[model samples]
Structures are given as structure tokens and as C-alpha cells.
Target: MGDDGPAARPNILVIMFDQLTPGALGCYGNRVTHAPTIDRLAREGVVFDAAYSNSPLCTPARYCMMTGRLPSATRGYDNAAYLPSTIPTMAHYARAGGYRTVLDGKMHFVGPDQLHGFEERRTTDIYPADFGWTPDWLRPDERIDWWFHNMDSVTRAGVAEVTNQLLFDDEVGHQGVRALHDLARDDDPRPWLLVVSFTHPHDPYVTRGRYWDLYEGADIPLPEISAADVPLDPHTARLRRVSAMDEVRINPDDVRNARRAYYGNISYLDEWTARLTATLGALGVADDTVVMLLADHGDMLGERGLWYKMNFFEGSARVPLIVHAPKRFSPKRVAAPVSLVDVLPTVTDLVGAAAPAPVDPLAGRSLIDLCAGDPTVEREVVGEYMGEGAIAPIVMIRRGDLKYVHSPVDPDQLYDLAVDPHERVNLAADSAWSAQVKAFREQVDRDWDMDALHTDVLADQARRRLVDSALRTGRVTPWEYTPPADGSGQYMRNHLDLNEVERTARFPR
Candidate 1:
């Protein structure tokens, strides 16, 4: 270990998974799934039990992690919104400090400059390619293209099937391994920051033959829920719509199968994580690299009869955060609540790089001090989720054993996590804690205003409408809406029109 006085610099590898919850991991007391790789990493490093995503969605959470600010702070609050290029990213800071940065897998960035702060983007992401909003142009040998053209063929053949007919997790794992191998051989002498993102356990829960067979006979446990449960917020109602569970009558078998598939996907992802860790060790940089394993968000998987994410529930908000710093940092478990916004500052601290001034006075604190076992830091964390449609906004604050959820269009939700960890009971109407509920409401108002929080909602709607109109009209005309420079405008103007033409030609109307 370098001298403890602050000159130490360590290479950083951030491995992020999509829609992975902490309770699904073997290391987090999940007996159903065997996540040996993640378990080993936890044993070697610090495991944060209460780590959370700032927003319970992919693009927003990633934007927050990249900027060290909450999604609401940057006005990038939804999946459809783009991250403004004006913000400085940790990658840019590392590059300024003479480090070589490369990003592989999915960044989920919308716009023309998909590279964001990274010096090199090694793979074409699944987000831009799959979504018709972006251009059809793809790199010759992009990993996403490889999946679409090759791995998907295996999926179509049904040789590898899991929950929702998704691709095998090993396929993504192999891709990450290949990327790491290339990074290890790069001629750059400067320390490197490599980001490997995996789209496993997210959806279409399909896995390879062996992985599927591993969980074939295992009975997947259902999420804890009560028959009397009802959404206390409009945001939760919106989530119910997406999950297709708002109907009064539903098929129980379908729900059970979906949950089983989700768990199977999680187990498959665990195996791939194991492979990723082994590949890192084989590359000889394991000891010198600070490996952080986390998720963009989590899946509901039938929690309260929900299938997807984007609610303020603990099942969707809480995520897995494992940080394996080289032997210099003490290894232990941290029970404090930590937000994804802390990622950027934490990485900067580890590499001894200068963090830029706060854009919105960050709601997160660096985990570096926590890693060193600081006792003065607060254990409370706050999170927010804004509905994309007509539903009212929701804000959640978790402090110690209490959780407060405020919704503009519905009754407030208060849960004593220590007493009701599953959130089966709601104590808002009880006369005893009316004072506590009022205080929580006041705190929410002081921290944020639901009406004023949605600064970019209209702008986002305008951009989406512009793109959709272009796709429909097949003509690029100037509009009141301006597209993000990351080439989204040009892509929308060119590719979406072509798609419309193809569709019209394929099926004349």
C-alpha cells in the first residue's frame, strides 16, 4: 500500500448491472442464487447493505452516477431524457489527470456524443441501437451488433432459454472478458478507468443450457406482499400500468412464472459476474484496481404485484453496492444508506483526482471516508422517482429505521422498516404518528417541491414528439424543440424516416 498521506492512485474498474437487487445475490443472504463472484468480491472489500440508486431507472441512475448529482438536480429525471453535455464527468476528470479511460457495454447515453467523458467507446450500446429515436448507423464490430447478428441467432433457435426468452448471460460475460483483455494489452502507460456494463437479469430472462439447467428444479420464492396492499402514490400506480398488474383480475401463474424467470436470470448473471472477476485477476490488475460492482436500479419482480421497476418501493430503489479497493483500504460491511450520486466523488477520491464544483449541491457524500471507517457521517439517504406520464410525482426519504414517501396525488406512506421491512402495513392514517407524518411532509417540502421539480418534463416531451413526428411524417422540419447534439437530431431525421419508408413499403396502406 502506498503511504497513507494521499498520493496513492489506483486503477478503477466499475462493473454495473441492470435491474439487479441486493436480495437476489447469494452474498446478500440470497440462498436461491449462487453469486460466487460477487460473494468473493464482498469478502475482499466493503459491502454496503443500504446502497440505493438515485432514480429507479437505467438512464437517470447512470446520469446521476456520471455527474455526482441527483437526476432531478440535472433535470435528467427520466429514461427518455438526455444528459446535457455541459456537465463534467468523472471520466473527464480522470483523463485530465493523465489517465486513459475506456467504456464498454451500455452507458445508456442519449444524444450525439455518446462517448460522454470517456476517451474511447469500445462497443455500440443496446439502448441507442434498439430505440428508433437514434440513427441506424453502427460501428462495424460493435458488441451490440454482434449480439443482434450472432448471439440473437442462438436465442432465436431456443437453444438458450430462461424466463422471458432473453439471451444467455454468458454471452454478455464473454463480451466483457474480451473487452478487458483488449484493455490490458493497450499501449497506454497511464492508469486506466474501464467500465464494463452487463445487461443481464434485466428482462427477457433467457440463459444458456447449463445455467438454465442449474435452476431447473429450484422453487423460486415469491416477494413478500399482502392482499390488502394498494398503491399510496400515483407514481406507484404508473408502475402498475407498466407491469400490467393494475387490472382487478390477474393470472397468478403468469406472475409466478415471471418471478421464477427473474430469479433464474439473476443466477445466470451471478455466474457471468464470476467469470468477469476471474478475467480481471488473470489480467494481473486485480490487486491494483478498485473494483466497484453496482446496479443501475432493481426490478420489482412481483413485489406488490408489480413486475417491472420505477416505483418508490424499497424493492425498486435499493440496489447492491460492493467496492473492492486494493488491500490498502480496510474490508468491512457498511450499513449506512448510500446513493449512486456518491460514485463519481468516491472514484475521484480513490484516484486522487480533483472533483469539479457541485452542479446542484450534491445530495450525496463521498463513500471514501466511509470506506476509511468515518463515524461522523450520517446514515440517512434520500431518493426520488418522477412518473413519465400523467401521474403526480413521488419523493422518498429514508432515515435510520423510518421511511417516508410523499406523493402529490395520494396519501403519504410511512413505514418503520425495522418493524415492517416488507412494507406490508401503512401507518399514515393512525392518529398516533400524525405529527411524525406532518414533519416528514415539511421535510419533503424543504428539500424539494413536486410542482417545480419537473423543470425538463416539457422539454423531454417536446423532443420525443419531434422525433415521433419525424418518424411519422418522414420529413425533417425545424421545430420549437431542439435535439440533443449527441447526434440524436441527425439520427432521428435520417434513420427514423428510412424506417417509416421501410414500414410503408413492407405493408402498403
Candidate 2:
């Protein structure tokens, strides 16, 4: 063993994919996916089998992962909210510890000073200031006015129909690869922490011709959807309405087509990840790098009549997490349930960095010991989804073999995950599984109280707008709050006053 602990202090390369589920990868044994690179990573690294997102939505999940705090702790439990500046983020800690931190691709940051703790942001985001939907919050020149203005033209004329020509393509994988190549050439004396955030496998599911053809003729499975599958709880019923999969009531063929397209996107991301890894190797940094692969959250391709995310279902909450530590940690599968919040502490622990003073209690535990192959240790992962509009709140707890989901609007849901991995049967109302359901529900309630997950001014506003938009327009629009141009800092000072007006007028608090 080396006394210097060379393995303990390796360069960190964190690669995150947007909205990718473990089930969509070949390493997870998905028959339809052609994700060879990700599969190779799994073979070389420690693959986490039951890793989950603290929250199913994007911003909240990313906030939890970056801060080592629960989404509720940051009060950024929705996509529209901005990450608070005060949180002790992973990048900040790494930079403070003398690591050169670089961020490329999407961070989904909403306000000025979007760089957060990263030393540099290499690429401009493809998403508009208002999360790619509206131009109201963007600068006059920076707004995506063309997308909206030419929407009719594109729809009518099929203009720009070439494969992989979309904005996300330019910003995510390719930009991330370029950033890696650039970072490799940097002569900075300090070790580096590089974040390559890819926007792939997200919506508008477009990929290059090579990736698209990789999954040709692959049979994709459709989710189980039946009227009898309805939960006895009304809260779950409300959640089902907000779940995008509800709109996909088409035939089996259409479902398969959609699944194939989603797999194509995943494969596209895999190719880019392979390229990034190759770049690292070419720079002679592969052996000294600790590469961590994870998704901010998972997506429900069509599981149980759920599409997209923002639910407590397994397909939505469970994500793939793989950590390839430099030689010190042996490759092994971690079956224990883990959350994205664990990411911050794990990275901090690995890099020998100090966390911020007055750091809030972390909801996640470091996986270092677990990665060392410690047995007899287990963890229960919890997830929550506060319905945007009229949708009821959904809470889930997964301990081991059983998973319980509580809904305020619909019937409570219980599944014997060990027996029915597909989650085809609900045992909540079954008297035989009453004890299991009760125990899981109690565990969930205790966890919620422990984490202080509760409704607040911001959460309330989020819920109202989310529900209103879902009910009225059938989609959630990005938040459009703009700061003043004069840089007077008055907007930040008077945020409460502005938010009051916004809550009351814009979202009808």
C-alpha cells in the first residue's frame, strides 16, 4: 500500500445525465437499449442498484445532490425555484479545497451569478432564461424568440427536420466533451473537479443518425396500464392525472415506438459519455480520476400510466448511480437504497474537503464505507412529490422488499417489490399486507418529520401554479421572474415584496 494514499486523492469527474432511468440502459439489462458505453462503465465501476432521487423534479433533485441537503431544506422543491446562494455546495467546497472546478452544460440555474461555486462555466445553456419555454425573463437578444415565432412555420413546413440539429444537442454532450478536452490541457497546479452535465435523454428526444439506428428493430416494453390498477386513494388519482403517462393512452405499437425513441436518446448520451472517458484517457488522467455517474432523476417512459416524472413511483424516483473511484475502492454492487443527496458528502469526503460552517444537517450518508464492501448495512430511501395544481401530494418510502406510497387524494399504494418488480399489484388495501403498509407509512411519516418536509410560502405558491397550469393548460411553464437591469440589488432586497405580488397576482395565492 502506498503511504501517500494516491488512490484517496484522485481528480473528480462527475457526469450527470438529465432524466435518465437505470431501466433504459443495457447494463441494467434493458433488452432494447444499445447503451454499450454505460454498460462498460458499470463493468468497471461500482453500480448502485437502488439509487433514487430525493425529489423527482429537476431543480429540487439537483439542489439536493449539490448541497447534501434535502430539497425541502433548500426550499427549492420545484423546477421554477432558484437555488439559494447560501447553501454550501459541492463545487464550492471542492474549489475551497484548492481544486480547480469547472462546470459545462446545463445547471438549470435561474438567477444571476449562475456560476454558483464553479471556477468557470464553459458553455452557455440551450434552455432559455425561463427554462426554454418563454422569452419573457430573457434579455432582448438572449431570448429564444425564434422557437416561439417560428413554431407555426416549423410545424407547417417541417423546417430544420435534420436529426440531432436541436439546441440541446449543441449544448450538452458535445459541449461537455469539448470542455473535458480543454480542461485536460490546463496547466493549473491544483487537482480539478469537472462537472459535465448532459441534457440528453430529455424531451424533444432527438439524436444523431448513428444513435438512432443503433436501436433499430429492438423491441421495447410498454408499461402496465389498466383501469383496475387505479389506487384506492384519491391523492394517487390526482397524481395520475398530472403524470404525463396519463395522456399516452394510445395502442401498444405507439408505446413501443416511444420507448424506442427514448432508448435512442439514452444510447446517444452513452456515446458522448464514452467520448468523454476516452478524452480523459487520452490525457493520461484515467488512472488518477474518480468518475461518478448519476442522473438528477429518473423518467417514466410509460410505467403504470406515468410519463416523464414528478411522481413518487419507482420509475420516476429511482436513478442509476455509479462511482468509479481510483483503484482504492473495489468494484461491487451496492443494493442498499441511496439518495442523490449523498453525492455532495461523498465527493467532499473523497477529496478531503471541509464542509461549510453552519452546514445544515445532511439527509444523505457517505457511501465510502459501503463502497469498501461493508456488509450488514442497509438504508431506506424516501421520495416525495407535491402535485403542482389540483394534484394531491404523494409520498413514498422504500426500505427493502416493500414500498409504500401515500396519497392525499387517492388510495394509498403498497407493492411487494421483491415479488412484483413490475409493480403490477397494489397491496395497500389488501388485509394480508396491512402490517407492511402500516409500517412503511409510519416510516415515511417519521422521515418526513425528521427532514422537516412541509408546506411553506414558496411551496404553496409552487403547488398552486403547478396545479393551475396542469389543470388549465395541461403543462407547467417555466417561471418568468426577472431581476432589475440597474444592478441596484433592490430586487434581491425586495424579493419578499415582489414574491407577494407574484403569488397573489400571477399564481393567485
Candidate 3:
């Protein structure tokens, strides 16, 4: 961090939660665990009621949020698709606009170029960084057993003092607190952007006693449609087989316990958010920082018998987003549909980055436009699925009150969300809604070239599989991010003056 008069530039804090659905949060109308901190955030910030992931899988969703590009545009089709280093990210924009960017948790980047554009990233990502999770689109019936999620993660969910995810998130919180302390130093003059990503509430749904107790005796709701009554469409049936959902039976108690733990995990993250905001206030950086709260994607969490994300359904594709900056932006709820890809231009607009070239096809628009009490023009939000459960491209378009899902091989699903909130009925074949379906289908045709997309997906899959096999042969090195250490220059050193180091490290002058 260098330069001068940086206090005029606002600091940006992005709080990213993993796989926590908006419908489970207290602010979003859940009666499960009481999440006062996050609820308070919604009270003071602009909460987006319709925020969706461009692609629901971890790697592709995160890439969408980072670069403000759709998965189709970037060829980010699956979890193992490597993010090309050539693309400029939100971090790159921030750097161009003179900000110190840092990442503290799971970004799920699956390539050799791990950092993307962030100057420092504290914790290693939870998933593999190579092409290990690549899906074989060639073999639709063959399930990739090792990485494909099963019902075990759902049935085995319960309380835990310390699970693998708990340990990782705890360290993420620790590093985040430390990063705050580091940011508060007067010696560092550049405005900083700290992205504290937590891998929680994602899977193996477990929580500590403190959070678990918060949901005790509370009414934890079950999925809208149980597995017994699960309406299996052609695409959903494919998802069930790939996930091995038919192998296990989830009793009422198991569903209750799992939902209870998932709610508890949301509360657990609330405590973390409360502590971080308190830290910002303690460091006297609250007024100069604009905080954003969101998730990469949402979990189905047994919703409609779907356990994980990869579908266009509301439970899996929609995420919670709250932007809080009372000093600069007013508080108001926005019902307009937006995407994670919007985050890039929103951030770049806030920080005044070097603008993208005129020909750049970016899907993101500045959220600042919404802050000025302007009317929200009706717009369409598009999402796609080229991941594990599909042999062909699955595309989704949400416009106004209708949601249309198109799978190349399967029959399309059309739902008027205003009338059917649960997405129980598909109007694609209904004679009454034939005109609406026809209109959406026409737009789908205009938006995508299905034949070309299918070819591209298979080509990328074959290329990645070959590369993965070759890399596994001999002297194989993981592409996992190993953070560079700052040892001698920090704390104490035999050759340097300790007092000078202490003074420079001290915060608040």
C-alpha cells in the first residue's frame, strides 16, 4: 500500500458465504435460527430480493462473480474448468484504480494461476485446483463417484464441535480479523478491498453447540416437496441418478436435523459478520468502508429433493445480496433481478476503474444506478448449466414474473413465479400459456447457439480429462495455492530494528 490522500477513497469489504440459500436466513423470512446481525445488515442496507448465480457450481459461479462474465462467454462450463489468466478481474480493476486487494478464504479457483489478481490471499481453497472435477459430457449415464455429491452428506448431517469445514472457516475468520488489523495501519495509505469468503453452511451440514442451541425448540421447516412426492423432470431425474439420491431414504427426523443444522450454520456466519463489523468500527474504518454481503450460490438443502446446486430452481440458483454503505448509499430494498456477474461492474463503478473496452461483452451493470431512487426497468437474467448433471447445455431465463428453464434434450420448464411461488407447475406444455412459452423459447434461440455450445462443452471436457491423466502419471505437483510467506520482514528479525517494525505495524497512530 502506497501513495497519498487515500482516505478519500472508500474501502470495500465483500462478505461471501458459501451455499447458504436466501430463503433460510432470518432477514429473508425464515423462522429458524435468529440471525440478528445479518437481519440488522438488511435493515440498514439495500437487500436484493432477486440475486442469482450465473452458474450454480462453485468454480463457475465464483468466476462469474469475479469477472462479471457469463459462464458461456468465458467457457467456464464446469468445476474443473481452469480460469484463463488473460481475463481481467474485479481485483485487477481495483488495482488499476489504486486499491490493495486481498482474499481470505475459499475462492474455488481451479487453475495454476491461483491468485487471479488479488495481491494477497490467506487461506488455501477447500477444493482441488486442477481439472480433477471435470465432468464427462460424453458419458451421461456414468456418474463421477468420487467428487459427485451423495445423500450421505445429507443423512449424516448433525452437530459437530469441529468438522473439516468448521476448522477451515474458523481459520478464515482468524485471518480476516488479522487482515482488518493490518488494514488499520496508518503506514498503508491505499484504500483496501478485503474479500472475506467463508466456506460454511455448504455441506456436511454441522455446527457447534453455541449455534446449534440457537435453533433448539425452534420450528425448522422441511423441503417444500419431499423425495416421495418429488416431481422428477427429465433434467431432475438425471440429477437424482448422478447424485445417487435413490440409494438412500431420508426420514422426517433426518430432514429436520439437517435443516436445523443448516439454519445453525447461517447463525454461525451471522456471529462472524457481527464480529467483523464490530472490528471495522473499532478500527474507525466503518465510515470509510462499504460492505457487501452475498453468497456465490445457494444450496437446495433437500428442496424439491435436490441437495446441491446445479439447477435453475430458486432454491439452488438464487443467493442473498446486501450492500451496506449508509454514509454513501441510502437504505432500500430492491426487488429487481440481478446476477453475481453484476458485482464486477458495480465494484469497478464504485472505485472508478479503468473501463472495459467498448467491444467487451460484460453482463454486469453498476448497482449505483439503483441507489438514486430510479425506477427498475424490466430486465431478463439468464443462467446456464453445463456441469455434472447434464449431457447438454441447460439454460435459464428469468424475466419479470416468469422463469423459463431450457435443457437441450429435456422438455423445457416454464413457471410464472408470481402465481406459483413453489415452481410446482411447468407451463411449457399448457395450452393456456403457450404464447408465453413460445416467446421465451424464441429468446432462448436468439441468446444461445445450442449446437455450438454442446460441441464446445464436450471438447473442453475431453481436453481436460486428457490433461488430468497426463498430470497424474509421474512427478505430479498440485496446482493448489501455497501462499508466499512474509517472515523476516515481519515481527522480529536478527538484522533489523524491532522498535521500528513495531511503530510501523501499530494502528491508529
The TM-score measured for candidate 1 stands at: 0.81
Candidate 1: clashing pairs of residues: 111-486, 112-486, 112-487, 113-486, 162-206, 163-205
What value does the lDDT take at residue 370 in candidate 3? 74
Model 3 regions more than 4 Å off: 1-8, 227-230, 353-359
* Best by the lDDT measure: 3
lDDT of 3 by residue, 285-331 (tens): 88788899999889888878888888988989999999988776678
Q: Write the per-residue lDDT of candidate 2 for residues 1-509, one digit (tens) a residue.
A: 14565555678889988889888887776877887788888887888999998888777788778888775566665665557678778899888877888887777775445777987777665453342221121122232334422112111221133444256555556766766665655455677888888776765444555666766666667676544564334543444543322433446665565566667778767777889898778776777888899998887765665556766667778899999864767778888888898888788777784434326787788888788888978887766664242233456778887778775545788888889887778888899988887787777666565233433523445454455446446464544322223555323445457765444332112
Q: Alpha carbon lDDT of residue 339, candidate 1?
A: 83
Error of 1 at 206 (Å): 2.6
Cα lDDT, model 3, residue 79:
90
TM-score of 3: 0.96
CA deviation > 4 Å runs, candidate 2:
1-7, 128-166, 224-236, 243-249, 353-358, 387-392, 444-509
Candidate 1 local lDDT, 231-285, one digit each (tens): 4455555444443344345355454455555566666666767777787678766
What overall lDDT goes with each candidate model?
0.67, 0.67, 0.86
Q: Taking the candidates one at a time, how many backbone clashes does each contain?
A: 6, 14, 0
